[model samples]
Target: MLKYIRPYLLWTLLSPAFMLLEVFMDLLQPQLMSRIIDVGVKNSDTAYIVRTCIIMGLVALTGVVGGVGNMIFSTKASYGFAKDLRSDVYRKIQSFSFANIDNFKTGSLVTRTTNDITQIQNAFSTCIRMLIRSPFLFIGGIVMVCTISWDLALVVICAIPVLALFVWFLLTKGRPLFMGMQQKMDRVNTVMQENLAGIRVIKAFGRSDFEKQKFKTANDDLCNASLKAMRMMSLSFPAINLIMNVTMILMYTFGGKMVFNGALKPGQIMAFSNYVMQILFSLTMSSFMLMFLSRAGVSVKRVNEVLNTQPDVSDGTNRDAQVTQGMVEFKDVSFRYPNSGGDPVLRHISFTAAPGETVAILGATGSGKSTLVNLIPRLYDVSEGEILVDGINVKEYELNALRGGIGVALQESVLFTGTIDENLHWGDDSASDAVIKEAAEIAQAAPFVSRLTDGYETALGQRGVNLSGGQKQRLCIARALVKHPRILILDDSTSAVDLSTEAKIQTGLREVFGDMTVFIIAQRISSVMDADRILLLDNGEIIDTGTHNELKQRCAIYREIVSSQLGEEALKA
Candidate 1:
């Protein structure tokens, strides 16, 4: 808990000052009450009674001022802490490698950043304010009680053991229950998140009933865990209350006898009773604050675990030799996902692409085609070998310099909620209107974009959900083209576009990108048939490499794929 709160130390320190002022005000009221009862009410003096009543009212007003000041400091600190902590977590998440991201359940990450932070905030608000209040009242109450009668103060101390025992039980039994509750919340979040993301798949498969049952089990487990924690907490509160009531009753009987014997004045006995009650009240408050800290302790540990994970890919700053040209080479690069103890994704691979050449990789799914391209941008480190650009190992180049040379259209395209121009500007922020228009036209995206009511300024829904898959692909292509990167990678980006549009895009790409290097990964043989070089990959190895005519005569796998996709009549025609 301290780790999460440490960042906001300046405000936290300021927060206690206001609380101390509030405690001083509270102390004044109790002292004034005793004086009013003993000197004013019992002495038949109207002037003294009126004066003391006014003093008590002034103390209450001071308490109000202290409360307002405390709120100002606490709200500013808690909100600032929440905002900065969220930004820190989000930036840390972006640094994680693909393998590290896969280790976490998506829902768990969401819950930790959101719900868990709220829990910590609530604990902060309660603990800091009440923490000072409890301790001040306890100490002040003891001093006041001793002034009134030392004998009665000793009696109150006798009940201290009971309060200590109750608090001990709460801490011992409730901590584990709260920890289990947090884990249960994670499971609940996992099921809910999975269902939300895969709702379309669930509906398509007609598995509504099965999904409902799974959700029910997760929800019930969370409910049971929460109930168990509440039960343990309930026992502590009632036992403390019982001890407080019994202690008060014994004080009343003993003090009443002493009052009748004239050994104690009526005002002093009343003061003694108030002091004893205040002491017990502080003890009860301290117990509650301690309970909340236990829960926050668990939450802080989980949050810290995510923050402490070292990213597999490190950003290399101060890279002197940036990849100036589009030249790329791979020297026996290989990778195996940590969870899967199988063969590496790419084995004994060696390749080089000169500037101004089009290289195409054709393979079935899971042939490591995407993984191969991912290494170019240094998204993941190679297991055993090195990848180089411009004659320098990729790892030696800064991340910004290495990625700046390339523009990638991934297999899964994403768009933010903004006008079309805003999305396009992400590739190159200073692009002129003319460059955006030219790039959009070259990608064959202008026709549909022009049909929209607002054209280039048209607002898009999140993920471009309103656009057709083909239109979204074309926009992604245009965004990539606008940057004029030295190397462009299209990872099956044109699969959704019609053949006519695809041909037009290819023709346009040839004219403006004359000396640029392009790496095209496609399942369609037609997509890569015209490439300067074609490489057929299977099971992490390149099975064949040749031009279109050369592969048709010598490679059986290329021939079979061509025959199956286009058919004998289509191929012959």
Candidate 2:
């Protein structure tokens, strides 16, 4: 946080310097008023009154200038600090691997980046202004009060400890409540995010009422938590006001007696009262600033948690290593998610995928087929064994070099809000129109894309919502194709496309990307029937590995699957 402030050090220092000027001007006001009342009025001098009045106006104008300067510099320093911190946090999140992302909820990360940073930024701005002004005013007011009438000053001095004790009590109780309030905000955001992303699903299932209730629960929790913290903080101002009012009453009682005894003049008592108010008002400002700091303290810890996290996957020392042949191998590989405390999701998975071959994977739901292919690009590291890409251990290759050579389209086809051409360019920023159209043709997406009024220039909705499911899948495949990767993994990418279109895509892959190693995960028998080899996975292990026909002949599980999808007549063949 200090490092962020350093860049704007000039502004940071200038803010407090200007605030000091304002406090000095404010402290002069009471003295001038006392002189006008005591000297000008008592002597019956009209010119003296006018002269002092003009001086007071000039003093106020100077204070205004100081206040404006303070506002300007403090705003600059605080906004700059927040910008740098937010950028670093976002960049750190981008560098996180799947494993690291799993450690935090998506909503929690969003809150940390946005709301938490905002809280700290506001607190910083308040500190720059009030932090300097309050203490100076308090001490200066005390000095001025004692100079006018030391007996009245004693009344203010006694009131100080009571105010201090009240503020301390609220701050101590308020810190934990503020922390809990922020956590509750995280929960509300999580519920809202999940609901928005899955609104269509919720509607389809007729669960809108249920989702509304769930959101209400989260929202109510946040509202209740905030009220608790606010209630505690709200007590400080009134309590301090009550104590200050009582002290003022005591001042009038004692000072009136002093005036009757000719020990103090009426003008002196008036000035003394102003100084005491100034001191107590400064204390009120201090209490509010302390509350802001307490809330910001919790925010600081939350933000630090994100910035300090070391990503589970990072670039290796072998910065120059590149994947040349698209050869991927898993040797007795086994993996379990970190902290899962359960059986490995994949076990003893050994295979070699050579260039120019298409290997298809078949499995039931949760059978680890997608997980096996994910290890190729090192999305997750093998727990008990090793994975090699182009004969080098995956951990030995630079992350960019390794991932750049592989293209992956997951079960979920995610597209951003952009023109069709822009989304395709994500795979290769410098790809030419000819290369893009050719890749689209190979993925069977060109015809539909060409029919759009804007063709490739057609703007897409979020996640390609404007496009049909099959259209979205084809575009995703086309994007991966644009990468010209040496290896491509299509993880049930064509699930939404018709059988004939899926067949055409499979044929196009063989014809256009003959030298690329391809791994296909599909539930449909027809989708993988023509592959060079098929791996049948069950319960996290490969039960059979062979060409389609060999598996049909040798594996009972394979026969059952074939019979179910292609029918008993196909199995008899």
lDDT of each: 0.84, 0.92
TM-score of each: 0.93, 0.98
Q: What is the lDDT of residue 286 in candidate 2?
A: 95
Task: Indicate the TM-score of model 2.
Answer: 0.98
Off-target runs (Cα >4 Å) in candidate 1 are 1-10, 341-343, 568-573
The local lDDT score (0 to 100) that residue 443 gets in candidate 2 is: 95
Estimate, for each residue in 116-176, the C-alpha lDDT of model 1 and write its tens digit: 7777777787766777778888898888888877877777888988788879888988889
What's the true lDDT of residue 76 in model 1?
A: 76
